[model samples]
Target: MRIKICGLTQLEDAQIAVKAGADALGFVFYPPSPRAITPEQAAKIIQQLPPFVMMVGLFVDPKPEWVTEVLKQVPLDLLQFHGDEPEAFCQSFGRPYIKALRMKPDFDPEQAAAGWPSARGFLLDAYTPGIPGGTGEVFDWQRFPASESPSWILAGGLTPTNVAQAIRITQPYAVDVSGGVESSRGIKCPTKIHAFIKAARS
Candidate 1:
């Protein structure tokens, strides 16, 4: 399964995630998030990372101008829309993107996905009141959509301890984590990173 390590803050943490075999590294751009980093900070980290590691930029309901500004500074390989961004707005940036869908009560994955028809994939995350994502709470894996037509990226509250089981149950195209591998908020633990990747791919 492909692995995406999110909420990256420091360069060392990013390198360890890459070295530990992460396929993609996610940089948070929303200001309200504690893990948020400036485009310049993300650029410096991206510059040091070797090619072939997909760099993802995470955004909330951001103004088009803000995205343009970020694109100018960081060479992001993917954009993740983690809030209530419409399909037109998402497509307007002219970059590949994935839409985050919180698995709230009665959530219809297929119906929601129909909105972003051209999305690269869909990230299914746990739902918490007033929180967009990164809540570190796992939703019921059984809630995973029955149809596999669209690529589904399983995220939220995944750690080394349960990742293998999650993959076995949900059979997702990819898995994403943030707090699960962190030594603390915005800080990743090398051991956790290695262990999580190993567990997911095992």
Candidate 2:
């Protein structure tokens, strides 16, 4: 029942999520995402965080040099690959990373899990054109291959209203959310954050 609130831009919202007992905070580095935050900005937010709170950096198909440069600036606790990055590419950075799988109707989670052995976990999210993640859409929760996969993070369209049910069904290692608790595209709602976490933990 770990809670990760993604797409945090404002320090207040980030702090609020932390106060609300979020296990992790995700900062999108992918420019195309509305929730995207620059490395410098992300650093400012990260610097003020309390200990034991995980800071995750979300990246797409970034070049090796760019990823290295970003790490030099921001002390990210974990890396989340939300695009088409090979296992070698993700592992080359020498950091723990979570691989995101854009689940389609016919996607095989077992096969996807085999491709990313080094990953700390696998995040299952909805697939939509022109958006890497945070589509605020839910797929068939019952379709995930949890029996075969060791680690899985359920994402997409999860909120306080249905998160408990989702957790009951998926029993994921963690839950990564962005748009589900948003006030807008990237703005998080503190009330929503509290409710979501409470539901998950209950």
Q: TM per model?
A: 0.99, 0.97
- Candidate 2 deviant stretches above 4 angstroms: none
Task: Give the per-residue lDDT of model 1 (tens digit) for 136-163.
Answer: 9999999898678799999989999999
Positional deviation of residue 142's Cα in model 2 after best superposition, in angstroms:
0.6
Best by TM-score: 1
What's the number of clashes in each of the models?
0, 0
Top lDDT model: 1
RMSD of each: 0.7, 1.1
Per-candidate Cα lDDT values, in order, are 0.95, 0.90
Residue 14 displacement in candidate 1 (angstroms): 1.0
Worst 10 residues of 2 by lDDT: 143-152
* Residue 20 lDDT in candidate 1: 90
